[model samples]
Target: MEKGTKFRIIKGIGLAALVAALVQTGRPSLAQQQPADSTETKQDVIRVETNEVMIDVVARDKKGRPVRDLRPGEIEVYEDGVKQNVTAFQLIEADSAVASSSEAKSESTVAGGTVREAPRPLNSLRQIKLVTLVFDTLGVESRRLAQQGALDFIKTQLPPNTYVAVFKVGNRLHVLQQFTNDRKFLEKAVERATTASHPQSEDLSDKIRKSLEELRQMGAAVGAAGSFAPPGTPGLVSSGAIKSGPPIMSGDGSVAMEKPDPVRLKLIEVTLNALRFTEDTQRASQGMSSMFSLLSLIRAQGDLAGRKTVIYFAEGIQVPPSLNELFRTTISEANRAGVSVYGVDARGLDSARTMRSSRDMLVAAVNASKSQLEKGSDVALSREEVMSTDTAESSLRKNEQGALEDLSISTGGFLTANTNDLRKGMGRIGSDLGSYYALSYTPQAQTYDGRFRQLTVKLSRPGINVQTRTGYFAVPPTAGAPLLPYEMPMLAAFNRHAPGKDFEYHVAALRFGASTNGVRHQLLMEVPLKNFTFTPDAPKKIYRAQFSLMALVKDKDGRAVQRLSENFPLEGPLEKLETSKNRNVFFTRSVTLPPGRYTLETIAFDRATGKGSVRRQELVVAPVN
Candidate 1:
């Protein structure tokens, strides 16, 4: 929680999916995404990408049984509210489907004297689904509980052949376990692992504090009387006295003391604001970037990977206002990758006092005083002040989980909340997974126009309930597509890049220490987000800058001991970023290796332009004495 503090994490190699992503460098050029079959002809050396939009449909009957017998005609597809032709439809489950497999109707016809599939695609008959369990270390209340719940579910509830990969998202994203059906290895991973943390959220006190402030503002806007008084006024927070309140808990469980305790309240407010900003900023930068990393992971998982469900367990996720695109982009990638996310509110059901703080009692005490004052004297309050006074527990729940639920719904995944027993939720999720189906469709008249597209799924039967992915970005077909920020070429897997000045950036610090795996090193890179070229039609006050980074630790043999890749997403006020350009916008990565001499290669690439900078630093991990 403090700046410059070193976080001990079990530093190790992440899931080896970046290599597969390397081959997908840039974007798809044409509809010819797949390689030419032996039965087909190589028309040109220039490859045209053949791709298909795959959607996983989870249909359930009125009684909640998995609807395993839905036919292709019974399902409908819509993107941006327009009907699309279902090119391929089939059921993908761990068990057999009640309905028969649909005929693999080849849309190809004789073209240029050779027969080819019109969609130019892979065999989209049906695919395999791998469940990805992602734990939010910083967001969840207890990491041990998350581990235990995950392990218990795996042992008792996980179906046979259901490959699962465990990931931890704390200060950074790390693959705790590779995708495997083996429960033994996974159980060990849950037990011995350390270092992975999830989204860092402020505690209950912070939420309550924020809510109190919001309610005050709302009350002021509503022109309420004797409620919350606005700041900069005669009585509230504008006092020259600057009194700090003692840390006393009142009846309502909020900071008790007197009104306009700006000194302490502001201190607490500032701290909470910092934490909130950090969480939102990380949500856009690291959280979404990690999701992009999974596109690469899908390659290692398997080519025909079916419903790649990432069961994301977190207390809550609040996307920064300016960074909503990051969430959208993350979900779009998931749609393209056919990955469904099952979001579990780790806070769970019950305990109405969850995330409560001094703000609660503070409000009641202030209001009680205000009520007596209003009865005795004429005291007018703003509408926002009144609204702030009335802000309730529901507001906190919505504030905490609204974004998370939207994300889950957008991805056509189930969001389990209102209860503490996630094991029961996990059972439901596992059962739903058993009955999920994959639907692929080609656009009849639509073109990849390099824009965002909204997708919707519908069922023909009334009593049946179906859930599937929401939408995807319409990336117009191109002759060549630029690589995503994190995509790395295989050749650069080793620390091959020498320190050079292709771009302007700074290395804030690099510290080395001992860890469970081996010697550990942390590298921090700082960049001025304002230096980025601003895209058109962005938020009025906010701007976005995108870049990709890769770090590699290579032994003296030129073998890469560990590799780190990050696609940095920056969003904030244009003015603040410009003014604070001299200040640090830091990015950190940790690597662990056996005591040895190694080359640490760091690369920063700007996606807006293909320009980048690479630095190779020599790091020696002395034998632990």
Candidate 2:
């Protein structure tokens, strides 16, 4: 397609598709209209909930080193101000947490399979813990530092029982190395991460730049208000305000005040502000999808018992406050899934302070505007405009990095920031995970009403700092916003790509012999338990888990012809759980159709982590005699 044609299509379809994706995914509808009466507007509350919560507690000494010596008896747990019994407890070694890398390395040396499609024999959780190392080449300035960090981690810090996989996140997330113990394989993965094949972060664009540009455009439009004229007034209208007056657009996306009446100036300013808000809202809304993708990757490890950690290395991307709620929701899901996130600020020492001043940006914009003056354009800078520039510049990174730190702290991992020594940060992580206590509690309150619960873990001993998740959303197993009768999450997933880019799960469909009325399509939903974080609720020696499945069959017109939802509740003895987890969760689904074309969409979600795998397929039914 030609570039212009493609651009036109994107501009036309971006908003329509974006809204559909958000609504199908159960997010609040953006750009909802407000009643003309100011008093009629009311804010709708978003109720988020979760049942079980996992908090990773990291203890550190005065020198910021991991404190390995701490007992469950010395720790006290609380939720929403009430004390709760410590129901589950265990210790995880970075190297020996579940499976040490050393053991896996030795086994890789013995049996080698060059075939990537061949499935490796599943092993017990105690034999290995899965570590997925993601390289954020997009958000990081020092890709070399991040690469060395991973190499150093594999070469020096990999535990004997730990198996590490690699992924690179640039324009999109891609797998590098599958779970492997082989050091050489890991080093090669790290090397490939530094190549030019990685997408440039520049495509993401700078929000500060965008906001400043909006401000300049608004300023220019408002400055010309001096020549404001009324269209109906022959004297003023003849002055040419009507001729020069560009179309004014309203918040509701409707064109209003067609004539440039002096009275319309207020309406015009309101329209401009509304337009800016809508643009920002669109950008922020799209951010939620991106964040969900990252969280999905973090939770893709199936049936892997023990510690699941995603050390995300990024300078961080700024997300709007409206979207920050999604950030919290993703973290809450991670805590429930027993996933601990370690945020590695890839920028190391962020040194843009001197260059990122608002005044500097203002001066640059003024210079650019002067150059544009030759083209009959002008820029008006007001006190408010300067402050707006400053605010966007200074606060751009505050919450972005804060969100990263929130991910680390909530998951009982260290937020390593403000330093050039990536190796040292890796060392701290190694020491921390080497020896730690795993503890769980059944909250006194069992109600899963999607409310926030405060969590506090106090140490009996002094001079030792403890870290874990701050809180969790009390969401029930089936908690979610119901989609329209014709809509499902698969709609968004399939629209983006086939087989979904969110979670990691596999499914296969086989058509059974046709029946009289319709065909029986048997679907095998294969979910590897290792991809999920399993917490053994102690005292009973049972690890309970929940996996959800939803299938939708849409006709050629995209109408939902059939649908089904299944919630699989898994519980078994801890040791036996290992044997059972190695196997995939398989189930069959069927839908009957007449002679016609249709779309088959299936989604498997890890209930605890909120990660999902979506699969889409096209089906054809021939007429029967």
Candidate 3:
């Protein structure tokens, strides 16, 4: 079959399967219901979902220099004015995890290979969480210049192997890039954020005017040229009148050879396309509306529950008016996903000097135009009318500033004023990100009653102000358990490998599986040699493969109970098949009860080349009645 036909068949089948899955999930065709408390159980049991918390502490003196010597006990935590115990504490160091050079290559081989080396357990005992950088660039006049400093800061300051995602927020939020350690890719994405006409900006009018002017110039030049006679004529135009014929003349002695200039037409087309792009971007920038993008990114990163930092960049945030409720919902979602947002005020570095100067010039031009119009009309402006107009203009400027301040405060990020030393401000931001501390604690209550809980983190040492998320949304009790049972199968499908003629195929799929019975899940994954076929006559082939699988299970008190390792082999031909499976069960099994959350992780490694892949999942099991 042709590739086109094959693709169509595959696409149709995929669409049908997706529709069936949606129906099976009992979700509406047009809209799916939000995850709610299960009504099947009669007992009103609230399950609290445990989330990894990563705090970014900014310690500065009267003059802004980072103070990094603070200890764990010097910090205090409060939830809505109620003090909570700090269950975990740690000081993150540079050598937290050892890096392997050939890890990627080892994991890609078909032969079962040991991919990931075991992570050396840290002495410090702080709960780790995923951090995302939300970068907002809406208010910035030059995105390219501003993004450079921001990208440099992140690349140089963030810890190695940190799960980071980058987003640009303006009139709309755009996920410019997803979580990855590839420094080059991140830099390229940042540099690509050039200043374009945005939906909310007044500069669009100038763009439109330029487009119109170009179009007019083309029209005039085409008109000045007489009807085309020879092919090599300077102003000769293509006559689109005929389907397939030479230039045709009209009855009025005019040749039907007049056509719009291709260059101008192309320009107009590009301008129109840009306008549409701006509109789509505007819609995406709405706060919380772009959560799905973040969710998808998290899914791609496997389990985000065990990450050190998340950096957020954005220009402005327009959260819902019911901010308190919205905050709870957003926080709850982030907690369940094991992620926290560290908003990098992308707009903060932009100096207002250029924009202020431009505005002043524009104002002067407008006033001069008004004065000329009045003089030419031989009419005098009324004093009251003139005063009213001035008042209105002043109000508009004030409103713009107020809007910027509101956005900065609502998202737990600071607003940087337009200053001469823009790069200096960015450098300070980088230092703050690099030197911050992280803190995590479990709440006394396990129930999320849809109530707003205020969070306060204070340093025992005076003269230090800790900036963190104001609070998080409380999770409903019943919604804490794993809802889908096919998570493993789905993961396997995603990582399945197909073998060709000369090379053997090896695939390792990993996911943190939740267990309520304390009877730990012993996943025995096997890849039969017979399932893969290869040419025997192709040079003497030695397909040696090794891979490792690591699983870590932690209980409510943030203590690791079960840490397991398994190695597997991949080799042999179709007939003489070699199969490998690794399984380990936890002996000290205790069923999860109310008031605790558990984290599970699985890492697949190739022993041959020392490459590996990782997956993480969280499970919250409530107590049995």
TM-scores of the models, in the order given: 0.49, 0.49, 0.39
Rank candidates, TM-score, best first: 2, 1, 3
Position 430, candidate 3: lDDT: 50
Ten-residue segment with the worst summed lDDT in candidate 2? 1-10
All candidates' lDDT scores? 0.49, 0.51, 0.38
Q: By lDDT, who's the top model here?
A: 2
How many residue pairs collide in each prediction?
Answer: 49, 37, 45
Q: Show the lowest summed lDDT stretch of 10 residues, model 1.
A: 28-37
Question: Which of candidates 1 and 2 reaches a greater TM-score?
Answer: 2
Give candidate 1 misplaced runs (Cα > 4 Å): 1-50, 97-99, 102-127, 138-141, 193-303, 350-398, 476-625
321-381, model 1: which lDDT tens digit per residue?
2234455666666677676777776666533533353346446535643543344222332
The candidate scoring highest on TM-score is: 2
Q: Give per-residue CA lDDT, model 3, range 1-625, as digits (tens).
A: 1011100101112233433443442221111112222112121234567643444445676677766676655777778897776654433333343212222322221112222222335321122222344444445443544566556655665554343334444444444333334455456545544443434223323333343344445556665343333233332223544222222222211222244434223323322333333332222222223332333322222232233333444443333221222323444434344344444344444446325634664465456435533442223322222222232233344333333443333334454544323456456555544455545566766664444566777777888766555654453322111111112222222233321112122212122224454322222222222222223322422233333334455676656544433222232222221211111111111122233466554444343332234344464443334
